[model samples]
Target: MKIQRRTVNSSTDQVLDSDPVIDRIYKGRNAQSKDEFDYALAQLLPYHLLKGIDACCSWLYDAFKAQDRICIIGDYDVDGATSTTVMLKGLAGLGFTDVCYMIPNRIKDGYGLTPALVDRAISMQAQRIITVDNGIVSYQGVDYANANGVSVLITDHHMAAEKLPEAVVVNPNQLDCTFPSKTLAGVGVAYYVLIAFRAYLRDQGHDLRFNLLELIDIVALGTVADCVPLDKNNRLLVHHGLKRMRSGQVSHGIAALLSIAKRNPKLLASDDLGFAVAPRLNAAGRLDDMSIGVQCLMSDSAQEAHSYAQTLDSINLTRREIQANMLDEAQKSLETVDVKNEKIAIVYGEKWHEGIIGLVASMLKETHNIPAIAMANDSDNTILKGSCRSIPGLNIRDVLVDFDLQHPGVLIKFGGHAMAAGLSLNASRLTDFTEGMRALIQEKVTDDMLQKCILVDGPLPQSHRNLPFARLLLTKGPWGQCFEKPVFDDVFTLESVRKVGQAHLKLSVRDSEQQYDAIWFFCPESWFAVRAKQVRLIYALSINDFNGKRSVQLMVQHAQVVESLPIVS
Candidate 1:
């Protein structure tokens, strides 16, 4: 399949350039400077989604005045954990103490606000049930809460259904909302709700003494972990969060997680939060209960946080083992079937654990470079629950929605954003559903869309791989999703190569003037076919701090050997 290359002319690619002006715009830290902050704040002046915020704030203030017992129903992932933490801490700062949180267990309670969870909330005698990161599509759950005389206020950023939930939904994706930035993570929306609550308290002449900006670290952690686009608003949230984290003002859980992962807090970047911190937090939810993770975030004592961090670290190890085994099994299953011939890769196993289907789908997508879905049949019933992960330019949610429209009774329920989603169906419909999805993809996705390529910002000299250069990049970044850390292209001559840890290859690469060591994770051994030739490399700059010494490293993304025609060179 031929792929269409997306290229911008040199003169027109201003935003992607490494120039000072472009850097200032994309870095988003200039918001800390008075002049730049004022200028940027002026651009946000026309946004008026604060009206719904005002309504949400009024409702919360009334609940506070009446001394209502509030229960927060949070999702189990990092975004949900951070969102729950932000709300718990934010409300406590507003002098509201009658608050408790419940994170749904991934295995038992499933995702979001289920009827079972709503019943649990009622059993706890909660007057109000506030949802973080979830509850946007939980129509039946919200109805159960309403029937039980419980009010619900939902703060989320997931894609909404055509028929909204019967609750005070405050998602920016709501049809009525006109917020300029629509790319907020669940934590970002939760923070905004708190901002509105703070504004309401100020209007009522109340003193709120907590620093709201301190929660930016949580927001940054979740936003990057969830892979949300970092627009202006999200960028602001992450920038401030990265600042506080680097300044040593982040939660003890985060600090301990970083410590356990051997990541240096002094020079942490956004990737550290996404890859190092968020996964450990999510491991608890994936393997056991998420309460362990939420407790880790909410704990103030370093000792308690360290204990939870250790538990989470242990869980992450177990999760790695589980995922490795599952991926191997899934790949073996793929080999028996003709996955290469299928337009949409849909594979299922009765023995596949539901908790790891999302990871399996991600692996399939990476392996085949196609839209992939994986399901695990429920042990008790004929129902199967699945998760999906998509490539760029493909909207998995929209595709599912289209599928639902075309084939009724096939999808029991599904909801999510453009790139990822979750769904359920009867086990009987699996074959037809797979065929329908493949036909849909073959009709929609062109041949050119299948090949994946690395996007390099520009070329960098080998001399830049040093401590001083690494420090400069680190200080200049609070980088995440869209405004990513710099990836450069270079031509390197390979000196030596050997497989490390089974699949990864460790290489000693030399350019014209300097040599550097690099590692490519999960690369195939066949890539060493042109070991002695110059190869083009795409990589991100990183600092490897080991045993108190730091050095810049190239985290390789992609590489291809530059071949010469016979006798043409």
Candidate 2:
């Protein structure tokens, strides 16, 4: 494994902050100017810049004027749920009375706007179907909807195909979309549609007082949960969303979920939404019905929201159990298989829960530092559904796209971001598909792409490793995905070490007699090699509060044994 230090970009230091540490961080992260650092909403790009937005808004305006039944077809994920809720609230607030939403079942209905989902929407009397976070790839489904006399509007943010569905598509990543930031999550696109639609309504002399910022928390949650890159526009959305959440102006559902997750809304951060709140909401979609999650997100009252949050939390616990069992089984199987010659890890279980396979794939990717895919039987047991996670430099989605092009009929359906994707095939073709994937991956694989490496922001100065700096680090950026929080590396002598929880390691480390508590959550196997010696630690600064007192803590990222220095007494 390689440990590399980040180099600051000099050109980005024009609008440097007062603190040198902050300036270093800003420059290192390529922050160019004051506007970028401030994250001002005014700095966000105009919604009009998005291609097809005008036509998209035209469809919504038509639906509004005609009083058509509008049913939102949403994907069964956090982004989809938030987008659906945002649309429901935004359209209803804009005086569209007959708006409703339906999230596809992860297990039974499959992903995106399936013909089955469209039929269900038509049954709901939908004259216009607006798809949120999906529908970009639903050619057959859109045809079915159109054939049924249902007009469809697609608002998605996934990588687009050369040919689009026969519907108005508003995706930043689409071929002709000149929108500057192509990294908007599905919810981000939905939010933008609402923005444009509201503007269109106001231009038509409707004095709608709906503030789009009211849904920023949901937008932030979806953006972070989807793990999209935090480009300028997305950062503007997320920064303000965190600001609103921290100020107690968040939605009842978000607040309730945070409360149930034991996260303080007053101190809400991006990770809180990503790891805590989003997972609980997603659990409902993964294990049960996404309608539960969508209802929770759109609940009218605190009591109702809390009830749903509790239920989702219970589902999340069950999901964790299922995930742990599946991961354990996969790990045990991999122990016997030599992965040295393999460029990708593909594992399958006949009885594995399809909903939990994505999480299992993510774990395997991190552990093996290679692309991983976990497959399970579809509800009918005749097809296999797989979720993929990839390492850096390997665009898994593109690989799937190219593979499907090269070997037609191997992949049933596939779509997603570069780092992650989903695909399915006939259960009978598992062996053929596996070989195709490995061969295709080998054609594109490089030794550098397969190498395990960790990047950090060099060393944290001994003088700057105090509580105040730690708190400052914690509050700096609501960081996730592409805009990662700074991780610093340094060598420290071990003072004490102990195992905590089930899989966590709690320890104390010293730098010249100054001791600090640290925790390695989901500690790797390498810790067992360096736990008793002086070690080079890669960690993010964190604050641990106990009984109203806060102290600096090291949230370990990686640790390796190093020779001891004689600087300490």
Candidate 3:
């Protein structure tokens, strides 16, 4: 692994509001001024700038005025769940009482708006169908709805296809659209649609008193959970959402989820949304029906929210167990192939759980520092479903696209973002698919791109290596994806090293002028077998709590022995 620090300009004196170190970190992340970091709703771009939004708003207004039955076609992930909930809540507040939602089962309907989903909506006598989080690429489903006298409004954020459906599409990624932030999560797009619709209603002399800002909690959760880039617009959404949650002014569902996850709403952070809440909500979609998850998110009664949250929590535990077993099985299967020499890994099993293959793929990608695909038998034993995960430089979806183009008729279907993708293929074509994918990845991934890189915000000065600095950094962020928590790399002399509860390593280390406690979670036993006194470490500053006391601690990310270091026992 390589360690490097980001560069920042020295002319940021007038723009920063705090410690010079924090200012440097912010500038290194491309923050032009302190205003860019502000979470005020006024910082968001006007909804009018979003292409197709005005048209969507007008269409929805006309439909609602006529009391048209509406159905929201949602995907099954966290983004889809929150998008559906936000749209449903916002629509209800806008006097659309007949609105309903339907999310496809992951194992049954696959992804996006299928013709079957349209049929279900039609059966419900829906006059208008709006797709949230999915439908930008759902040409056939959109056409099906249009043919059946139903208007389809697509509010998606995924990359669009060339031949788009003949519906009003509000995706920022569309070719002609110039929406400033293309990284809006599905929920963000839905919220913008409501904002535009509210404006249109006001023009029509309808006096509606809907507080759309209250829906920011779900918007924030979905945005962070989806792993989207934390651009200015997204950051603003999360910031307000966190504020609402911390102040106990959030929805019953959010409060319930926080309780089940053992996270105090008063101390909520973006990290909790990703690590605690999202997994439980996503587990329902991964293991069963996302409708249940949506029910929890859409709940208004505290009692009902708690009941649904407990059920989801139980499912998330099952998800973890299944993932762990599948990972173990996958590692055992790797013995058949030379994983060390392979540019990419494609592992499969006859009965591997399809729901957990994506998690397995992610684990393999991070452990091996290579692109990986984990495949399992589909419901039809003749076809195999595969989940793929890629490294930074390799766009897994594009690679799959090129592979499909090169070898037609092999891939059943595939679509996802740059780092992850999903597909199915005939069971017999597994060999061909693996070989073809490996060739394509080898052609694109350069040597430098293949190597793992650990980035740092330079070394922390002794003066700033205290609990106060750690606490200050925590307040400045709901960080994830593009906006990451600050980490630093420095040389330290090891004073002690010992194994903790499971696989973690506890250490006491000293730098030039300070001694600090540190911990490395999930450390391999072999890493401590040949311990060295002087080590180069990449770590993040953290406030460690023990016995009702808090102190500065370092959570080590990577560690290596320094050259010419003598073992001092």
Give TM per candidate.
Answer: 0.91, 0.94, 0.94
Candidate 3 structure quality by residue, lDDT tens digits, 158-228: 98877688898999988888889999999999999999898899999999899999899999999999999
lDDT of 2 at 382: 90
Residues 18-119 of candidate 2 have per-residue lDDT tens digits of 767777776777777766666777787999999999999888888888999999989888998999999898888889899878988888787788888888
Candidate 3 lDDT score at position 89: 95
Model 3: residue 209 alpha-carbon error in angstroms: 2.3
Question: Which of the two, 2 or 3, has more lDDT?
Answer: 3
TM-score of 3: 0.94
The lDDT for every candidate, in the order shown, is: 0.79, 0.87, 0.88
- The alpha-carbon root-mean-square deviation between model 2 and the true structure, to one decimal in Å, is 2.7
Per-model RMSD to reference: 3.9, 2.7, 2.3
**Candidate with the greatest lDDT versus the true structure:** 3
lDDT of 1 by residue, 1-569 (tens): 22122243333333432444334434332233333222232343232373367668878988999989899999989999988998998888888879998999887787788789988888887899999999888888999888888999988887776788888888888776888787888888888888778877888998768878767788788888888876666766776777788889988878888888888777988888888898899888888988898898888999999999999999999998988888888888778676656656887877888888999999999889888999998878689999999888899999999999999999999877678999999989998898889988887786666777655566665556677777777665556677667677778887777778878877788877777878888886786444556776777777778788776678887777775324433
